[model samples]
Target: MNKKQISILGCGWLGFPLAKHLISKGYKIKGSSTTVSKKLMLAEAGIQPYIFKLGEDNNQEIYDNFLSESEVIVINFPPRRIPDIINIYQEQIRSILPHIKNYQKVIFVSSTSVYQNTNDWVTETIDNKPEKDSGKAVLAVENLLKSHSKENLTVLRLAGLIGYDRVPGRFLANKKEVANGQAPINVIHQDDCIGLIDAILKHNSWGEIINGCADNHPLREEFYTLAAKKANLTPPEFKKSETIQFKKISNTKSKALLNYNYKYPDPLILVR
Candidate 1:
């Protein structure tokens, strides 16, 4: 049997590493980037490189080749922080809807921002009520993809990503009067993110929505302070608040369904 070919739409921070990992597991990877320079880099990393821009004019044959040859398509790009992102983001995904066949599985990399800060534990079943514009854009795209092809789609809703270069220390280092001091944080390391996605593909888990987060929920004040300290940066000062708003993302579905174990179960330990 030949190795399965998987095409990743975005070869940025997460996608780049993911492609390399998949390649190590004996799978062929076709990775895309909008940048011309990164094309050579991806090729060097053993990924079939393609220059794919969703809303812009792309080489139709190249784009089709990127989408057509893969057994699975991983849509891993994030919504841009633009004024008209809500409409533009949906349009970007919409452009590729026709090319995606029913047999080919899709892993839409979503975010946990789709859930509101209910100050309670959130699971897959809860109705999405995103509070931020970015979250709203993600939710809209999720709906679009599900409606377009629900059977082959799986939405992996990841929490705030923190690992490798994305040190939480720099996020609030030396910051004054940071809000939500007592609010619980929901974060997953890069290793866990890759692991979760691998499990999905290994098990052939499709048509599901899974939340990928660390098992431990640490307080914002505690986690960030330690993270800054660990990075040799000035610890941020948190403002005292009577009310704490937070959403603790649950990984029950992923753990149970994927039979997976988190590499970084505790964010506090991650910084320490």
Candidate 2:
């Protein structure tokens, strides 16, 4: 059997690591970056890097060529700087939708932020009532992908991404009063993120929304206090009367459907 070609959009941070993992597993990877400097890195990692930018009136031929003849497409890019994030993502999805071939599996890297700030356990079946601008934008793009994409689409709603030099210790190293110190932190390590994606690709799972998060839901102060102690920093003071709110997103669907186990299930494990 011929090896499947997998194309990854936005090969930076999580995407780059994912591409490297796929390549190490003997899959052909084509990745994209907006910057010219990262092209060399992508090439060195054995990924065919395409520098594609999304906008109205942008060249479609380039995108078409990049997406051509691919068995799987992973949309991992985000409009980080755009003010009208929803419109930007919508246009980008529309531009790429026509290029995707039928029957190809697509994984849209979404976020758990789409769920409202209610202090309840959230799952794939939760209503998407986003409270923030970025969350709303992501929800819009997810809807667009589900409705318009020709391929079988699956949405992976990830929690706060951690790992690969992004340690929690540095976030509050010298901070005084940090907001929401008592809220439970919803985060997942990069290794588990890649593992979950690998499981999905290996199983050819599609047409579902999977919550990609760690099994552990530690209170913010407890985890951060440990992280600070490990880094030799003082733990930030938490407001005693303030109620920190967050949604504990469940990964039951990912575990049951994909038969995948998390590599780093606990948030405190990384600090040790």
**Best of the candidates, lDDT:** 1
What candidate 2 gets wrong by more than 4 Å, as runs, is 56-58
Error of 1 at 28 (Å): 0.7
Worst 10 residues of 2 by lDDT: 52-61
TM-score of each: 0.98, 0.94
Against the unseen true structure, what C-alpha lDDT does each candidate score?
A: 0.92, 0.86
Most accurate candidate by TM-score: 1
In candidate 1, what are the lDDT values of residues 46-95, reduced to their tens digit? 99998868866565567678888689999999999999888999988888
Q: Mark the regions of model 1 whose C-alpha exceeds 4 Å error after superposition.
A: none
TM-score of 1: 0.98
